[model samples]
Target: MSVNIDLEITVTGPLDAEQAERIADALNDVAQDEGIQHDISFVVDEWEGRIEVVGGTEYPLIITRFGQWQPTFESRVHGAVQAVALAAKADIKWGYPDDED
Candidate 1:
């Protein structure tokens, strides 16, 4: 049996455009460093699986993993998200059932 998961990550806290860009950059860098293939995007409008990043920390940025993934792949993504959160100086909250710290 294949172990798969869907991760919805939200990093909360005050953020300007520059900070948001930095977060995205850090995520990409971590993904590259760990050799994890992913498609990550920042949106200003509501997406299918997420809401828009409005002003204030209440509607902060969100990062999500779609489809199925192996446990190892899930671990890599979790690590990468941690790095991104640290670099962005933000708080990470795992959404729904995949909540881990």
Candidate 2:
């Protein structure tokens, strides 16, 4: 095949301050793993920080972000992934069809 494919990954969610920090770290790893050479794109967008309800019911710290990937190089990040130590396990969404649906 003379055509090339663009590999991309995006991350987004609502999480606490700590969780958001961890997620951000994880996203960096993901981006490094995918590699810019492979046209990989990564991004994190923070949406909700705090939500309030009636009776002064304030919600915890909430954050939402997104990561996109597209490798411009070859062979991924070549094992030189930028990972963080002692970080929470981030939930990865692979865009797989909902089997339960």
Off by over 4 Å in 1: 39-101
Supply the global lDDT for candidate 1: 0.40
lDDT of 1 at 8: 40
Compute the lDDT of residue 84 as modeled in candidate 2: 28
TM-score for each of the candidates: 0.40, 0.31
Distance (Å) between predicted and true CA of 41, model 1? Answer: 5.0
Error in Å for residue 56 of model 1: 21
Q: What C-alpha lDDT does candidate 2 achieve relative to the native structure?
A: 0.31
Per-residue lDDT of candidate 1, residues 1-101 (tens digit) = 32223334344444455555555555555445644424333233234543323212222223334323334445654464455444323323323333444
Decoy 1 TM-score against native: 0.40
- What is the Å distance of residue 63 in model 1 from its true position? 18
Candidate 2: tens digits of C-alpha lDDT, residues 5-31:
222333333334554454445545545
Which candidate has the top score in lDDT?
1
